[model samples]
Target: MKRVLVADDASFMRQMIRDIIEPEGYEVVGEASDGVEVVEKFQELNPDVVMMDIVMPKRSGIDAVKSIVEKFPGSKVVMCSALGQEALVMEAIQAGAKDFIVKPFKPDSVVSTLGKVLEKDD
Candidate 1:
């Protein structure tokens, strides 16, 4: 099973994502409530994919993406953004996030997007 690290400031958001992905055979190895935690956990867990929220305390998701990509060149990061955060999403892409999903996540889109991103590695 592919491991995943979920980063979102809201506990409910993390739980929601966990619920959506876990049943699809993805192992959620870590959950982070902030960018700082995301970076720390990413280093510790080395998960196959990171679902990172765009806005968080301490460090923004884009910054976290930069940090992770710098440290782990093969890291696959997918940014989670709310509607109207297009610029931030583009910045995240430039920062090396492999893909992105908007807020109010649809289960199918979330699963399919993650699957596509992970498949690109093969």
Candidate 2:
């Protein structure tokens, strides 16, 4: 089972991601409500993949991704963004996020994106 760290400010979004991935055989090992917690939890957990929200408070997802990728080049991060945030999404990709999923998320898209990211050699 792949270990995933979910990061989003909304409680419902976190729960929804958990609900979507759990049944697909992914284990949600940790969750973060902001960019700071995202980095902290990432160091502590070192999960296989991180589902990060781009618009997080404090540090922002792009910054957090850069931090994680700078330290751990093998890190796999799939950004979560709202529709119309294409510029931020592009920035996140440039920052080393493996891929992205748009909200409101569809279960298949989430699962497929995770699968694709996990399939690649880090």
Worst 10 residues of 2 by lDDT: 52-61
- lDDT per residue (tens digit) for residues 47-92 in model 2: 9999999988998999999999998898999999999999999999
Off by over 4 Å in 2: none
lDDT of each: 0.96, 0.96
Cα error of candidate 1 at position 20, Å:
0.5
Q: In candidate 1, what are the lDDT values of residues 1-122, reduced to their tens digit?
A: 99999999999999999999999999999999999999999999999999999999999999999999999998999999999999999999999999999999999999999999999953
Question: What's model 1's lDDT at 52?
Answer: 97
The local distance difference test score of model 1 is 0.96
> Measured by TM-score, how close is model 2 to the native structure?
0.98
